[model samples]
Target: MNRIEKKLQSLQEKKEKAFITYITAGLPDMDHCAKLIRAQEEAGLDILELGIPFSDPAADGPVIQDASYRSILKGTNLRKCFELVDGVRKDGCELPIVFMMYYNTVLHYGLEAFAEKCAKVGVDGLIIPDLPLEEQQPLKDALAKQNATILIQLVAPVSGKRIPEILKDAKGFVYCVSSMGVTGQGASFHKEVISYLKSVKEQAQIPVMMGFGIRTAADVAPMKDIIDGAIVGSHFINLMEENQYDLDVAKAYIQTFKTELK
Candidate 1:
């Protein structure tokens, strides 16, 4: 099994909720990004979603947009992101790394070549927001050759008829968007969103993870029973922006989520 599926199996067997932390690779700098990742692993993160900064991140909100811009200014690209993962591996960090990127970058890098590099560098999985299910087959095939999982997103309020099709195409764990809009942390988690997550969980055979608008521990606590994992991005980027590469503070902030997990 790929790292994602293995991690999910491990978590399920232990009856634990997974804490997935998201950080924009090369935000302040690649060096600092590496440090933050190490810190996250130390902070007990189950999975790390390393955001590959892009110029137009349609799925991201202002917080992640600013982070992407900052990372690009620091010369972060797909290759550098891989190097960051390599750095982590060299340091003996075993926490699964998932590359969260855009479709344009993958196309620019040449899909096959990119997948090859990811496999070579020991990447566990990928999260491409813009790549639809229909277009994922080729990429999935390439990654499968190296045993890498292609994580698919399942949007909220999707039609009941579409759930089966979406779950059929999903791998690793299904990412359920808690909100209908762009990614950002909100004050409250919608009841309807929770219901939708439950429905998706019911239909999906694989583990289901909730992302989008998950900022604080309270936002994650309620969903722990129903979802396998919680992914926090915008909020963590906001922490990085506020702290300016202080990994200790970032790690301490991430520790709050650990408290919420059952």
Candidate 2:
């Protein structure tokens, strides 16, 4: 099993929820980005999602969109993102790293080459939120050639009927979007969203995780029984922004989330 599957398996053994967090790669700059990346892993992240900054981030909220804008200004490209991953791996950080990027970047970089570079650099998976399940087969096939990076799929509320189809080639886990909106911590899962999540859990053989709008541990406390865990992004981004990108403060913030999870 890859790092992601292994980490989920370990969490399952401990009867604990998995924590997956994201940081836009090369946010302020590569140096500051590396610090936050390591800090998230140290904060007990089961999976670290590094957002590959894009000019047009269609699915991200203002927070992530702003971060991507800054990263773009710093000239963060696909190769540079890989370098960050390589640096983390060489430093002996075993935390699974998932590249949360958009489909346009993949197509621009060439799918096969992108997957090969990810495997060579020790990346564990990919989370392309904009890619539809019907169009994922080509990307999946490319990643399969390397047999290293896994494709993580997102299933929204309206996609309940297609759960089986979405999870058909899913790997790492199923990123069950809690809200249909872009992505922010302020978003909440209503009764209908929860009911939909429960239904998703019923069909997902792999770990079913909730993302988009889930900001705090309290938000996920009631969801443990219905979903595997929650994937947090905007919350941490807001924290880092509030703390002026202080890695220690953000690291401490993550521990607080974990404490609340308990």
Candidate 3:
């Protein structure tokens, strides 16, 4: 099994929920970005969703969009992202790293080449928010050859009946989108959202993680029984931005979620 699967299995064995979070790769420059990654890992993050800064981050809200724009302005491209991962791997960072990027980034990078690089740098999984389930095959096929990185599936509240079909061949974990809109904070999951997640959990063979709008420990509390974990992005980015990109402040904030999840 890859790092993603192994990490999830380990967490399950420990009876602990996964504490996943995100960071825009190369944000505030690569050196600081790598340090923040290490800090988060040390602070008890179970999975690292390393976002590749894209010009049009359609799936993200303003916080992530602003972070992506700043990272892009700093020349953080796909190649640099790969370099960042490689650098961390060399430094012995064993956190399960998943790449969250747009389809255009994969398409332009060439699917086979992209998968090959992921294998080389030890990326455990991928999440392309904008890519439809049907169109995931070519990339899935390419990833199959590497046998290391999983093409993580996403199921939304709006997915209705299609949730089962989308997660049929899922691996790593299923990222269940908590709300209809873009990724941000102050997201509340009502009865319908919880019901939708229940349907997804029933349908999914892999562990299901709730993403989008998750910000605090309180947000994760109600979801404890419903999901295997929570994925926080915009909130984490906002922490860094609000603290002037302080790694220690970011680490302390993540520790709160980790404690809550445990």
Candidate 4:
């Protein structure tokens, strides 16, 4: 098993759910981003969803969009992200790191070439939000060849009847989008959302993690039993921005969520 599988198994043994955090690569700056990545595992995060900035991120809300824009202006790219991961590994970071990016980045980087690079840099998985399930085969096959990274699938509430099909070849875990919109923190954890997650959990052979609109511990409480974990992106990016990108503040903020999960 890989880092992700081992992590989920470990959490299951401890009767604890996973707590995953998301941060944009080169956000604020490359140095700060690197520090945050290294600090995350020690902060009590089970997995790190590191986003690569894209010029057009349709799935991201205003907060992530702005953060991605700034990272781009600071010269963050796919290659830079790979370098960042490699640096952290050499520095002794053992947390599972998954890249959440658009398909264009991987395509431009070349499928086979990208898979090889991820293996070299120690990326455990890939989450391409914009890539449709119908078109995932080629990329999936490429990643399979390298046997380095697995393609993590996303399923929204509207995915309705397509849940099984989406989870068919799923590896790592299934990213269950809590709502129908882009990534943000306003949406509530209503009964409907919980029901959808339950359905997803039933169909998924791997862990099912809920993301989008989950900001606080209260948001995670309602669906805690239905999901294997919770994913927070916009809220974390907002916290870093609000605190002037202070590493301690970011680390402490993540601890609060981890405590709640425990």
Q: What is the TM-score of each candidate against the true structure?
A: 0.94, 0.96, 0.97, 0.97
Please give the range of 10 consecutive residues that has the lowest summed lDDT in model 3: 185-194
Q: Over all chains combined, what TM-score does candidate 3 have?
A: 0.97
Q: Rank the candidates by lDDT, best first.
A: 3, 4, 2, 1
Which pairs of residues have clashing backbones in candidate 4? none
**Candidate 4 structure quality by residue, lDDT tens digits, 65-162:** 99899989999999999999999999999999999999999999999999999999999999998899999999988888888798999998889999
lDDT of 1 by residue, 1-262 (tens): 7777787899899988888878888867778778888888898888999899999999888888888898899888888888889888889988888988898998899878988888777788888888876788778777777666465656566545778887886777888888766888574455587688789889988888888888776776766678988888888777778877688887787687777666
Worst 10 residues of 2 by lDDT: 185-194
Error of 2 at 163 (Å): 1.0
> What clash count does candidate 2 reach?
0
Q: Whole-model lDDT, candidate 2?
A: 0.85
User: Cα miss at 90, model 4 (Å)?
Assistant: 0.7
**What clash count goes with each model?**
0, 0, 0, 0
Comparing 2 with 4 on lDDT, the higher-scoring candidate is 4
lDDT, candidate 3, 1-262, per-residue tens:
9989999999989988898998999888899989988988898889999999999999998999999999899989999899999999999999999999999999999999999999999899999999999899999999999898999989888888788788788899999988877889467554588788888888888899999888887886776888999999998888787888897897888888888777
**Angstrom error at residue 19, model 1:** 0.9
35, model 2: CA deviation in Å?
Answer: 1.8
Give one digit per residue, the lDDT tens place, for model 2 in 1-262. Answer: 8999999999889887888888989876898888778888888878888999999899999999999998889899988999998998898889999999999999999988998998998999888888887788898899889998898888888886788888776677889888877888476664588788888888888998888887788888777788888788988887788888998887787787776765
